[model samples]
Target chain A: MKSQRVAVLILAGLFLYLSLYTWNLRTGHLDALSNHTGLEVSSWVLRPGKWVADRATTLWKRYVFLVGLQRENERLKDEIGRLVLENADLHERDRTVNRLERLLSFDPPVHWTRKGGRVVAQRLGPAAALETVLVDQGDLSGIRPDTPVITPDGVVGRVMRVGLTASTVLLLTDPNSAIPVISQTTRTPGVAFGRGPGRDMVVEYMNVNAGLKAGEELVTSGLAGIFPKGLPVAVISSVERSDLSLFLSVHATPLIDAALLEEVLFLARTRAGEGH
Target chain B: MLGPSWWLLYTFVGVWAQHFFPGMDFLAPGLLVSLQEERRGNIIWLTVSWILLQEGMGSLFFGSTLLWYGCLILAFHLGRGLFSSTSVTLMCLLGAFLGALHFLFTLMIMRLEVMAFPFERVLFEAVLQAALTPILWWVAHQLYPRRLRSDERSV
Candidate 1:
């Protein structure tokens, strides 16, 4: 009799849970609730811990790691001087392009405003199945699903979920992530599909004679409607022609290292659609 | 002695631990300890909080955490019939069970959701979960307040 009672209780509980789960799947109310509460609380906890760690590292580096500081500063100064000359040259070219565009009556480009956020953690908790990182910015910071995340080096990923004050970024290294890309020089178009973490992503659908060579850069083609066009994504690592297939089996190394990501810039679309 | 305040502290520390050890359930051991102590109200609260936290952070659907803790509860109850509830051996066995469950449950959920399976990383985390569960349980058991014990309530 007792066993029967327990079994009935279990069945009833399962039924109720399933009903709730189904409702949540449809409405997404429960997911938002948990994100607002649980994800927010975790971010609050993690932020301080990250702050302390950053401060300690800064203090140590500033005070203790001074052996090569002078040499590094000299090197940085020379690089900055070179970059300033390059910047002036680029500015002149930009002015010429603007003049040419005005004369040709080309459409204005889409503008992106950048919001910076620090990565607090990577794939936290039991439910984090994807190769993801927790960024300390969320819906409040205009971070939404599919918002492009990038670094100075290259593309990072896109915002997957937004909580109140934190968001999850699905890294480009995750197998689920794919981005449309074009070769920098050859202009060969293909889709770059991630092949799990720590593995080079595969570029699919390019013709065997596409002329894509090793070390050639791949940039976002903006066909996905998420990432802006012409952002550096990856570099061609290996390209092979398979007799059985019409397309080249090409692999690329993502420009940004997911494991080394500390701070990322989230790109939000501008109101006027002019990104300089 | 375990109390509301202590539970809050445990949760704070557990969150930190979870941050350090990604993809492993740190609070499951606390639930196991709570079960051994027979704290019904605390059990419910902890389970709910943990479920929310795990589900919120996870990429899969919410029901996976429900199934995870549900299986843990069922295993604990069934194992209690054959072994002492406080036995370290029982915790180790439960930990191993949870480890295997993590792999199978994650794969099942990934399949259901049609997401790519992260076979090797999940396998590594499963082994970690198996090893960490009993150790965390030991830590929680050791740190539990003596004054809050049912036997010591009168004193």
Candidate 2:
């Protein structure tokens, strides 16, 4: 009994030391080690479960979910047709603006190398750490690292890491993540930063007098050219004065569900000449 | 068959289950603690499997689950004398409290790296834990009836 007690005490000490060490670990050592091990071992083990989950999702999509989606699609098609006819006049105006921009010496940003993919699975919460989506596109689809991903609505994030068959999106909401942004109405510029633990998008370092208002829409300021400029980032949710600094404390909710997005566009735009 | 140690065994099982399906939020570990009074061989096996699973998951820190489970089990083993498992209701409450304890501990440890502390997230997790712990405790109790009786044979 005495020896057992002593052994338990020793074990306890070792664990405490280990926990303390890991608890304070800021580097990526642990994550890397896990990945190396998990890659080699758990993939085979988890294959069955992943397969089942994938099949279930696929079956649901093809059967029970598709009929309603088809009906919804048809309805939307009708609505779209009606709207397109109604908006013919607006399209003419848009053409005029495009012509005027060309005539007035403005260069419109172009979309190039647009690759499409379906989101296969969402990485488990903090489970994936970086807001990453496992898309079914890879080298075959020409998806590459640093590709800007977007939805029909707005910018999602960028492709950070890619596997042969899958790629991980480094979400704009990751703490280490940032996007160049500008106010659509006034061209006020700032950097959009992720509020970690999945909070709203926030922009920082704008001058206190920058005239930011609640509900003002923020777009990807083309200043960086990394993003094709003018992608909607978020709307100003809150703006307040800081006690210690001249910069205002500002918050904006992201336009896209970084976690729930299932389809995205990968812009294979090279980081050629863009810094914001 | 393992008798009184079944809860401990299932806790280990929870860890193993995490290998297949990610995101139980240490529910397996917490359930293991409430399942029995102490750790045992099966419990150790369960923990190891989970550590391997989490390691394999490619997204978590190496040995994160091992460090967490090992530390908590050691602590709980020493501290078990302070709590009574007189009944299943009490056992569940104990289990839930422990589950909550683990969540708080993790948050404290991870807060430094945390840039955004969304309150909704914390609240959601807490509520999920509270709701799930008793269910897990009940299931564990069923698996190891002796833990509920508290007078069964050791093995």
User: Best candidate, lDDT-wise?
Assistant: 1
lDDT of 2 by residue, B14-112 (tens): 534544333345444343544364445645555565555444342333444554556556545454556654355555554566556545644554464
Give the number of the best model, judged by TM-score: 1
Report the C-alpha lDDT of model 2 over A101-166, residue by residue, as the tens digit: 433342234644466666655543223334455566655577766778876567788876554455
Clashing pairs in 1: A111-A275, A127-B58, B1-B144, B1-B145, B1-B146
User: Model 2 residue B88 lDDT?
Assistant: 52
RMSD (CA, Å), each prediction: 8.0, 9.9
- Chain B TM-score of candidate 1 stands at 0.94
Cα lDDT, all candidates: 0.84, 0.59
Tell me how far the alpha carbon of residue B80 in candidate 2 is from the true structure, in angstroms, after superposition. 5.6
- Alpha-carbon DockQ of candidate 1: 0.62
> Which lDDT value does model 1 have at B26?
85
What TM-score against the true chain A does chain A of each candidate get?
0.78, 0.60
TM-scores for the candidates: 0.85, 0.59
Candidate 2 stretches greater than 4 Å from native: A1-29, A36-117, A120-148, A158-170, A173-177, A194-200, A211-217, A221-231, A237-245, A248-251, A266-276, B1-42, B52-64, B79-94, B140-155
